[model samples]
Target: MVDRLRFFLNRIKERLWIKPLAMCLLSTASVFLAKMVDVTEIGQIVPLITLSSIETLLNIIASSMLVIATFAVGSMVSAYASASSTATPRALSLVIADDVSQNALSTFIGSFIFSIVALIALQNSYYDKAGRFVLFVLTLSMFAIVIITFVSWVDRIARLGRVNGTIDKVEMATAAALQRRRLTPTLHGVPPGTHVPGGRAVYGSLIGYVQRVDINALQKYADKTAIRITVAGLPGTFAAPGRVLAYVTADLGDFTDIDICQIEKAFLIGGERKFYEDPRFGLITLSEIGSRALSPAVNDPGTAIDIIGTLVRLFALWCAPIKDNENIRIAECDRVEVPEICLRDMFDDAFTGIARDGAAAVEVMARLQKAFESLATIEHPVMRDVAICHSRLALARAESVLKIHEDIEVVRRLAKFGNSV
Candidate 1:
């Protein structure tokens, strides 16, 4: 029973070894300091006579163990920090683009400091016996190693402070997703009878700026103005993909969990970045323009002539049944009419100028006929609307210009010479 009890006592001591070692080290240091003050004997109070060979041996073992543990912790933290910024990518390419190796350096510095300090403790013991002195030196070296490694554990915890922000962000997103799903899963869905703007089969999900707005009840919830934003795959017929389309207000909570960085991955310049090159979309494609397309460089006067001519012919063609059989010799005065050009410039100059300059109804009507006659071959559906809308908008603006045509000197001069009579 005595032998068994002794074995049990040893096992318990072994189990509780680290705490006792720490206590012994602190106590011995305190006693040494007391002896330095000339107030205590070499073995008085602290560490309970720790100048002994047995105590020196125990100290050496304890220090070695601490350094090993600290080093292990530092290595693990270094690897994790490296992976976080370098390996895991986000839509914002620069999100974690900063240095990953910096964290590893931090662990290295912290552990190094702990190791050196503990090593000094090992070398400076006040023991009288040579065996105990040797043991003290070994103890100091081992303790330095353990302290350095243990410092890494402290570093691992410190590093967590740096990463706590990312964790909080992720948590916020997850919570927002949960809340939106619970409150309104159909928040982004379309209204009755109308699909999303692009007529796409499935819009998956989206976020967009309200470029233009006509909301009746938007003020009830949030801002009533339109905010134009360029989000991924959110289409608008009235707007090109990047064009600001409307003013709108929406739920802030609904947008909270949205990963805007994910959407940026779909673009070369990023969703936030501007267009690197001008895109004519399908308007400038080959089917309409052919290999070499026409452009407005051919003639500036031709739009006014061509637009007016097309309208007259339309009226003539619609009114006179026999005109279909007749070949009209409307001159192609515009040397620059391109294959798919909208002639926004022409409408801006010719039609709007006429309307604004107070041109007579008969004169305005005549010039419009001439402009349409100038380029009568375009017939595609949307492009045709482009022309029609430009003409209409130009005319509206021209009428306004006519009211204030005196405010525009060049317009007044052009208006003076417009009449062929």
Candidate 2:
């Protein structure tokens, strides 16, 4: 339930309208809230604020905020487009969810709504002397908030859609997902080992990517039915009409249609993969950005090189040793079996495209080799092996593509150094 709620909240955040809508609601509420000041004894002591003063302030906000809000929307749209074109389209979601931009937009729209609502109330003579003063104070506070938010937002907007900023955003999101998975690799379930018990395969009715799996919900159902469930459709897995989402082992006869529906509900199938639960998606998106940079039109090896560095940092998170207290892996749902994310798959996602597209670029290959060397030095045997394997693959790609002998030699030397490490 917790996982499901978190996933839902993440999806909600991605919607550009959610914040603005929320702000509008609060703005409307505040206008009515000022009416309570009229009933308070403090209203008698407070100096009377003239109706014209409050009206003039609100008129200023009402006249200007809509235009500012429109400008903000246009700026955000351009930023989104810039992110999609400069980086991978997959990263546009992260760009859209930027808090500063959203807050600024909300403030602009909220201030507009507040002005309009307060204007309507003032026209109707809804406020007493104290209510008018309270409203004036609220208006001043709103103006201050709008000014501060706009200033911070301007700084953030300057970089929001740039290639480097987009890359940083993707890296942070990927690192967070990787760190979460590092702590709970099995999603708090038993590891699906070499052998999984045979059971009735439960296929998803919908076709899409598995965005999230509710392991606790699955465990509860499994406990009720005294069955073991092996999850096959992890997040990022493509699910089709006939694809098996999980294998349900039950002593009873086949599960009813409703039972199957309930089990499938535990998996949230979405049209596109999300970064929240799937770390590989982030890696793949980063790789895509690098590949785009290496394209003939872009031809930006520096971006590709920077992406290599980011991948190294992310992979290091996986290789870092878990704290002693966290070394113990306890399966919160013993009846549910979830396969661990493959190190080989992560390697392929992070490096394969860059290796292929940037093979002929000596600078990219050299940096790639250096990144491999760094990963090779990690103490984890699996990480070392995966790093070595990718190093060889990238070296082979480089050798095949480089026409210059010295360039080939440089990559070869770096590859050899990585191997030795």
Considering every candidate listed, which one attains the maximal lDDT? Answer: 2
lDDT of 2 by residue, 54-166 (tens): 88989999999999899999999999999999898999999999988998999999999999999999999999988999999999999899889888888988898999999
Error of 1 at 49 (Å): 2.3
TM-score of every model versus the real structure: 0.19, 0.96
Candidate 1 lDDT (Cα, 0 to 1):
0.33
| Candidate 1: worst-modelled 10 consecutive residues by lDDT | 285-294
Per-residue lDDT over 1-421 for candidate 1, one digit per residue giving the tens place of the 0 to 100 score: 2323542343343232333345445534543443243333433432432444445455454445456445544654554454343222121111121222233333333333333443345367534343343434445554454456456545554444233333332223323322322232222222222223221111222344221121112222223222112222221122334442322222342444433333233222212211011111111111111111112332223333333433333322222322354443231211111111123432342234333332333344335434433323344344344345544444445455354444333333333322321
Which runs in model 2 stand beyond 4 Å of their true positions?
251-258, 324-329
Q: Which window of 10 residues has the lowest lDDT sum in candidate 2?
A: 251-260
TM-score of 1: 0.19
The lDDT values for all models are 0.33, 0.91
